[model samples]
Target: MTIQWFPGHMTKARRQIEDKLKLIDVVIELLDARIPLSSRNPMVDEILKGKPRLVLLNKNDLADPKATAEWVQYFADQGLPAFPIDAATGTNVKEILPRVKQLWAHKIEAMLRKGINPRAIRALIVGIPNVGKSTLINQLAGKKIAATGDKPGVTKGQQWIKVGTEMDLLDTPGILWPKFEDQMVGMRLAATGAIKEELLHLDEIALFVIKYMVQHYGAGIQERFGVQDLPDDMDNIQEMVKVMEAIGRKRGCIVSGGKVDLDKTSLIIIRDLRAGKMGRISLEKPF
Candidate 1:
């Protein structure tokens, strides 16, 4: 599918971020733990060059723990400090301060050279929509410091939030790239709720989720849904139909036409999976 989605404000946002980068000591890039590489904007690598970076894989509680560990190692091998955090529940939030300190050691030394006791280090939180950027900021701030909502684009302008004694957060609105070059990347982003629902094909994305689950965590699916005799040669669409039929029976999503409403079934399955009701499943493996 040729996925075409780009908002008008993104150009302005990119320019603004480029302008703001000169004033920050470190770039704290937030990525969804479920699909880190796909969610990351390549422009960030270019714009954030020469600055220390901390890649926080947020919403890790919703992703597979094993995959999260692999991603941590992968980022570390690439010479970046990476941490898996669940911003919603504040898991592993305390570790960020020390990591930030370690990343900005040179800046700290520069402060000492100026005979100035640095009060706080400034960092920017950036990510695509619904990647838990505001959630992370609120977690680090220890309060509801940033306006957070379930939908994307809730944060419009930039806001500075005080996270701790010596750390401040620059929160920006979630921004999507100009175009998705990889089809798999687009599908993965759609599956994780990073892309707007209206722009996606629900049934196709649902099938993708089913296929991913069957490949990576089929046992989990069988255990959760109590489907003992799953077809071995079934494709993703067929597996999705099985899941939809089961869910339709469970939720009584039957129409007057005596057929399962695939649309409603798809919505139910996707919502449950995204909310971690199905189980913790990660879509991508660490490189």
Candidate 2:
């Protein structure tokens, strides 16, 4: 099934960002390390219109280091400096301001040449929902200036937050495009909790997670859930269901008649994946 989510507030946010571009010196694009490409909004490049941008892969703590490293290099190859950071734990966050300054160094130097002291860098930070935009902003500001939540759409409005005297951040609400052109993108977002759970079919997301892990991270899944004899065919729906059921039984997700509660089991699988209980898993890799 195709997944689409475009709230009315997000439309307003897009327009507001355009109106405020005149004041922005640099754009910060935050992406989930596990699904960096998928978490990126397609409209970003067109909207920002070649503005200076620093791509930050947030939530790296829960993502596979190998894949994250590859993604960093991938962005670097494209001339966009990208790095992995854990906004929640403040890992690699200290480098943000330095990098922002580096991106706007030319502008800063121009002011110095005219005998004028440069002002704080005006940065516009944008990202898809639940990609840790709020958490990163709070970390940078060294306080809770932005609302933080695990679910998407926690920050509904744009707010200017001062990051000391070095930078001023414009935090915009996380936005998704009107429609996901690729169905896989929707599944990955839903599986990673970037999309609201209420808008998802949990079973489908659970299966997608299982199939991905089985293909690229079978050992971790087998060790995490103590399930063996994983199906060889990635397209075998029935075999995958058996594996999910086995995981549910192991996790004690049983209901009336001793049948596995698929819904609860799905939630458990997705939760474990997000919480890193299944190890440093990444739903996608740099292609």
Candidate 3:
């Protein structure tokens, strides 16, 4: 099945962001640390042209540290200020405002040069679904100003929150593009819980993730689920199933007739990875 999610309200959210962009001085874009390239909304570039932007890699605790550093440099090389932060633990979240100020330094200085003391800075914060945008806001405010959940689409509308005396932050609903051009991108988003779980089958995405872990993180896969060995081939479904069955047997997800409960096994794998029970991993690395 081709996995995609573009609800009607997302269209409204995009228009709302576009309308507010005119009054905003800076835009903070949140991306999933595990899938930075896949989690970025393509519409942001067209709507936010000529605006100062700080790309935040949220959920850094769940991703590879080396890959996160590379991604930070990747964005920096492209002239986009990016930082890795864990919204849940407030890790490196303290540096967010300073970077925002750093990116908009020229504009902030220009206001002073003209003898015009700027008012509160208006920043539009945008991200794809379930990227910890709401949690990050709460971390910044040191209080819960926005609703948050593990599932996507928890924040249904927009609200202006006073982050500090000199800045007002606008939290918008997470908006997804109309289509996913690459199928792997869809899989990564779904596996990372950025997309709703109901939209895709956990069994299939778990297999995809297993294949990746087999090739790139074999030791992690073995250690997490207590699988004795990694699968031999990515294209061979039987070999993949063998590894999954071993994981299921280790977790006691077996039926009365001695058959492995694939659904239960897949869900355990998915939830474990999502909760970072597996070792530090990144689905894709910058080439």
Ranking under lDDT, best-scoring first?
Answer: 2, 3, 1
lDDT of each: 0.77, 0.85, 0.81
Measured against the true structure, the TM-scores of the candidates, in listed sequence, are 0.86, 0.89, 0.89
Write one digit per residue (lDDT tens) for candidate 2, span 15-120.
Answer: 7678778779998888999999888877888888899999999999999999999999999999999999999999999899999999999998999999999999
lDDT of 3 by residue, 48-81 (tens): 7778998999899999999999999999899898
Please write out the lDDT profile of model 1 over residues 1-287, one tens digit for every residue. Answer: 22244555667667777877766878888888888898888677776776899999988999999999999999999998898999889899999989998998887888899999976888887777678776777787777663544449775655667776788777553354623578888888877777765687888777777777777888866766665555565564675577757766667778998788878877776787788877898889975
Clashing pairs in 3: none
**Regions of candidate 2 where Cα sits further than 4 Å from its true position:** 1-4, 7-11, 146-160, 171-179
The model with the greatest lDDT is 2
Clashing pairs in 1: none
lDDT of 2 at 250: 95
**Cα lDDT, model 1, residue 194:** 79
The superposed Cα distance between candidate 3 and the true structure at residue 211, in angstroms, equals 0.5
User: Candidate 1: what lDDT?
Assistant: 0.77
**Model 1: lDDT of residue 36:** 88
Superposed by TM-score, candidate 2 places the C-alpha of residue 218 at a distance from the truth, in angstroms, of 0.7
